[model samples]
Target: MTRTSRRWAIAAAAFLAAPVLAGCAAGFDATTVKHYSPTEARATTVRGIQISQGFVLGPEPGGKLPKGGSAPVYLSLTNIEQQDDQLVGVAVNNAGTVKLAAPIVLPRDKRVSTSGAAAPGATPTAGTAGPPLVIEGLTKELAGGEYIAMSLQFANAGAVDLTLPVVARSREFATWAPAPAPTTQQTPTTGPTPAATATPVPTATATLTATEDASTGGH
Candidate 1:
C-alpha cells in the first residue's frame, strides 16, 4: 500500500474508535441513577389508608418535657376503601404509653387531619375537629431531628409501622402542641370536732360565804 493511503486509513480507524473508548471509560452499565431530593414531609400508604405528612411537634421553648413526659403526633389519614375503618391503637418503641382518647372513625373517601382546621361539614360550618395521638409516659427525652419507630393499629387493616420524624415547633408546627392533660378534682376532707367542757358551780358557794362574813362584820 502507498504511504499516503496507509496514513489516511490509520486516521480513520483512530476517529471511529474514540467514541467507543470513551463509552467504555464512562461505564456502560444499564442501571438507572436515582436522584433524591429533600422533602419537607414524608408519607406512606398501607391497605386502603394513606398516612401522609407524619411529623412530631417539638416541645415549647423551655417547655421541653423530661423523660416520661408526653408529646403529640400529627398526621393526615385518608380512607379510600368503600367501607369504614377505625383506628384502634398506636404503639411506639422505647417511647412512653400511646393513648387515643377515642377510636378514630375513618369514613370512606374522607380525609382526617390532626393539625389543621377541619373541613367544612353539614349542619354547622365550624367543621369537625380531630384530636391528635398523644404519647404519654415517654421513656426518653425526645427532641428535634430525631426519629422514633411507631406502629398504628386499625380495626380491619391490622398494623402499619413507620419511622416518624421529630421536628421542632416552628412555623406550621407551632400550633401542633400536645393536648392539655386531663384535670382531676379532689374532694375536700373534714376532721372531727372536740366536745365543749363545762365549768364547775363552786363559784356560787364562794359568793354566799363572802356575804355571810360581811353581815357578821356589820353586826
Candidate 2:
C-alpha cells in the first residue's frame, strides 16, 4: 500500500474510536454525579398549620424519672391561615399519658413556642405553663439520643404524627427541662380539743335567801 494511503487509513480509525470513547465518558458521568441541597432537620406541615423544630427536653443528669413520671415537649406551631386554631390534645406511644395544661390558641399568622420566654400573664414558676403541653406519666425513661412517636391533635388543623427527637438538657436547652413536681403542704394538726366551758349553777344559799325575802314581804 502507498505511505499516504496508510496514514489516511490510520486517521480514519482514530476518529471512529474518539466518538465511542466520548459516549462511554458521558454515561459514566451521568451515574457518578450527586446533587445535594439544604433542608430543615425536623419540620412538618399539615393542613394550614406548620409544626417545626419539635424536640423533647431530656432529664437532668442523674435525675431521670421512672415509669409513670412526666416530661415536657417543646415545639413551634405556626398558623398560616387567616382563621384561628387550637392545639387541644397530644398523644405519645410508650411514653405514658399526655396532657395539655391548657389548649394552645394558634392565632392566625403567628407562631407559638412551647419553650422560650413566658407569654403575657403566664406563670413563670410553672415551667410548662408557657408551652401549654405537658407529658405526664412517662412509661419509660427517655434520654438523649432517643426518640418518641407523638401525635398532636388540633381543633381545626386535624392531627399530625411526629417522631420527636430527645435532646439533652444542655447549653440553650438547659432551661427547657421539665418543671419540678408540685409539692403539697400539710396543715398542722391540733394537739388536743379544748375542754367545753362549764355552765354556772345557782348556789343553794342564794335560792334560800330569795325564798326568805318573799316570806318576809308576805308577813
lDDT of each: 0.68, 0.68
The CA lDDT at 171 in model 2 is 53
TM-scores of the candidates are 0.61, 0.61
C-alpha RMSD by candidate, in order: 13.1, 16.1
TM-score of 2: 0.61
Q: Which candidate is the best by TM-score?
A: 2
The residue-level lDDT of candidate 1 at 186 comes to: 97
Q: Residue by residue across 100-175, what tens digits does model 1's lDDT show? A: 7677778887777655454233111123243457778878776555677999899988898987766666555665
lDDT of 2 by residue, 66-131 (tens): 667667777777889779998899999878787678777888877777654642323222344444
> What's the lDDT for candidate 2?
0.68
Which regions of candidate 1 deviate over 4 angstroms? 1-39, 61-63, 119-132, 182-219
